[model samples]
Target: MEALKQSNPGIVVVWKHKALVDDVYYSNMEVFERVFWTFGPCVEGFKHCMSVICIDGTHLYGKFKGTLLVATGVDANFQVFPLAFALVEGENISSWSWFLGCIRVHVTQRDGLCVISDRHAGIIAVMNDPNVGFTEPRAYHRFYVRHLASNLKTHVRRNDMRDMFKVAAYQRQERKLVADMSLIGQACTKAIQYIVQVPLPMWSLFHDVGRRYGICTTNFSETFNNVLKGARFLPIMSLVEFTFHRVNKYFTDRRELSQTRSEQGLAYSPKVTSIMEKNIAKARYHKVEAYNRRLHIYQVETKRGDRIGRKGGHRHTVNFQLRTCTCNKPRIFHLPCSHVLAVCVKYSISERPWVDRVLQSEAYANTYAPQFSQDRTILGATD
Candidate 1:
């Protein structure tokens, strides 16, 4: 392999699918069981006091021909908790059910806030089905992937659903889902509603992307995918090493990020502060009951010509602010209105603070920092 690599610099050694890295690497049933079973308690223990759980799944291209992996985590301070991982056929209900069941068992606190994830039928199935949960309110959850759908692609039969995506996202849309999923689509919609209802010990449990005071979706499993990126292509021993190394790096980097954030004095940089203030001001856009009534009256007058309520088509009419657009986003659901984005523009108010910290790098860890005393406490650093 070394000789071949030396000769062909571009060569990527492709191993057969489902190849185990160790005797226990998915091959040893006991090891597989251990890895799989560890998910619930591990996550349960990790998310003990947290309010929201951000969930997502990605394909871990490996020896298992075209197999995928699904996982979830809590995103406090952008910290990642390894909830679970399973080699699965595809990202669907069955896979999510198994994963959620593990989490449900581990999530003994019958009262944590909802889990957030991208809107795939699999996740929606878990969230929407009344039978999926053991008790009341059915463990509320939400889906933020509505932005993934585009207008030409038409994610929602009702205009309300399509309108829920980021405005820019909806305008520059692509049709990924071909067949129209009417019932299943609604199930996903209801699932999101459930997410908002889950009781949170505090508002901090949920993230308000765009700072819009609503549950916005971020790909929670994105980092896990990064951890697995090149590791998936390596051989067994290499894969194991890669996992440990990256996970180690993940923790190391996270610690550094925390310390750096602390030193930066909570005041943000001028540019970021400007953006944040703008977003906050945008969020400040509030009106009383009269404002809503006036808006509703205007909408009735303008959209009177269109048979919006009758539902001649799969699309439903959605209302937002002064706009009575036909989409499920703001009108049907009080979530962000992608249509508003189309008419107005990206409101700066709803953006979250954590995302901006990465680029400034000021509050982010200097990856190769020198280690000093215990806890890697910088030689001159305090706290």
Candidate 2:
């Protein structure tokens, strides 16, 4: 640990020790309780990523059994960007609160941040605690819908009921969410009651004021954990070394990939481009009807056979000036929905301008621009 500090002066490494007395310390082995670390480059690079963070905890299989809590962020291209990690004795309110306090101090110190996590009691308590919590004006907490749905199995085990619960959680508009939840309530009042206990904004995308950037799960952190499966059995310091090299390589590879995509003249990342293409294709089935140039509004009428929303034809209002569609897809996902694309086609407007800046290749490149130092290298850095 001393060597790591000497090598990377900018890295944030925190250690908590069990106290012996006011001025005295416990023995070296007996003192250590928890440790948190964040690479310097990661701390700097996270500024370019979205404000949404996904946090999850995994157990360490090392000789000293401890819990590995990780906080991960999403880049502009929707790729996982690991931010900070901590080694704790267990998953409990005290441990989680300590870890979050470190994150709040060294990492995300800004307002309007959104944190996504599974419905872990420890995490819930830490976020809700008034004295040491992510208060309203500062940060918002969101739950992983997949984890929340798992609780519904106790009340209703049917697949259709589960699907109804998902529909309510995943809806991007409040009216549609109400309609779906009403349907679920009619099917199983117990399931609806269970869901109502959780705040709508925490799990439902429609009501979230913070820009979650379409990230609704802690799967990003879970995926990173899977990548570190083989390293979990190493010694405490060895495990930290393993993560350092793995993350270094991740940034290096992604930086090269972003450069290649830019050279190819790609305006947006591959994921964003694919979504736009799919929406463009769907736009063919809809026809643009009335246009109010003064109001910058257009009415997109769905074909009689179209089946996206309800069965028959439907009319959606599109306001180009506001970059919103009545269907709510564009505003929700920050991409041009089929309805909005139809309006773009009618006006001969380019779709590139409508794409959110965060989805562009420039933002994707910026996310990986920070270089990890190769000179101060860790031994056995490979998986």
Candidate 3:
């Protein structure tokens, strides 16, 4: 622990032990139960990433088996950004509470942060507790749609259960969500009861208020788990060393890439730029009609095109002041949709303000700017 702190200043390392009882000998050493650690660079870099966090736990293998809990964020380029890691005896209320508590203290205290995870009883309890920082005002707890769909499958016998649930879960409009839910109900009446048991906001994007950033699953954390699959079988100390090197590489590689992109005069990161380009192309055919100049409100009507035969053109209302479009894409994804871009084109206004700051190239560079310690702390390893 001292060595870790010495090599990586600002790194957070917390460990817990089993409580001692009166029956135990006084001289007996405390039994180590779990340890949680987050690199200094990761903690700092997360500020430039999205506010949404995805957390999941996987079983570790080999000698001294345990469960590895991971928390990850998504960068501007939509890449996985590992935040914190923990090695616990198993998944339980105490372990999850301790892990989440450590994250709140050492990681981020940003309000309105969204955390995505499975329907684990331990996680539910930890997030529901008012004393924990995962609750409302401090943070929001959201259920991963994949997990909810998985749970729904236990009750509904339909083969297309996941697809139906996804249509409901990913809907940006409440009316569309209700329509999708009704379709599910028509197919499997039993599913409606189980689905309604969980709050709409908990599993559906329509009520997420843009906190989810369109991410409906814990796939980022799961990807990180796959990246560290080989290290999980090693001893605890070896695993820690492996994790340091892996995360260091993650930072270094992305840092160089972002610097290169910034030098090339890119405004937004790769994913954001791609989305903007697509929206701009689509906006070419949108006809905008100004409503209120002071309020920056306009009605954008999509011109009939080749695909209009099946999917008719849509007329959307865009409000620059509120940064919203009736299509719900801008508010939900924090980027200007085709209709919103159409308004910008008509008024000759710059669309930069419409984009989320975190999705910008500057933020992408900041996310990977922090450098990890160069010193290799592996046992009996030379520089």
**Candidate 2 CA-lDDT value:** 0.79
Candidate 3 lDDT, 1-383, residue by residue in tens: 11223334645566666545456744456666677778889999999999988989989877769999899999999889999988998898888988888888878888889989998999999998877788897788898898788878766866588679988899988789989989988988788888989988888888988898999876788789878979878877677778888899889999999988888989999888898988898888888898999989899988756545635367889888888888898888999898988888778999998889999999999999998866544322211
TM-score to native of every candidate shown = 0.44, 0.89, 0.93
Off by over 4 Å in 1: 1-50, 74-82, 107-110, 128-138, 151-165, 168-218, 234-241, 263-383
lDDT of 2 by residue, 217-297 (tens): 667888888778898788767877788888999889889988788889889888888888888877888888767888878
Q: How far is candidate 2 from the true structure (C-alpha RMSD, Å)?
A: 3.8
The all-Cα superposition gives candidate 3 an RMSD in Å to the true structure of 3.0
Rank candidates, lDDT, best first: 3, 2, 1
List the lowest-lDDT window of 10 residues for candidate 3.
Answer: 1-10
Of the two candidates 1 and 3, the one with more favorable TM-score, higher being better, is 3
Highest TM-score among the candidates is held by which one?
A: 3
1-383, model 1: which lDDT tens digit per residue? 01101112211121113325455355432222111222122333343323445676554455633233534454333344444444445677866676566556433345534566665677777776655562235455654544343321352344544443233222211122111233334546653343234332112112222221234446456666765787555543344334445544655666565455547664433434554454334322321122243343211112222334532212223234433444333422222333233223222333222223322334333322322112211111111
Judge candidate 3 at residue 264 and give its lDDT: 90
Where in model 3 is the C-alpha error above 4 Å? 1-8, 19-26, 308-310, 376-383
Give the alpha-carbon lDDT of every model.
0.39, 0.79, 0.83
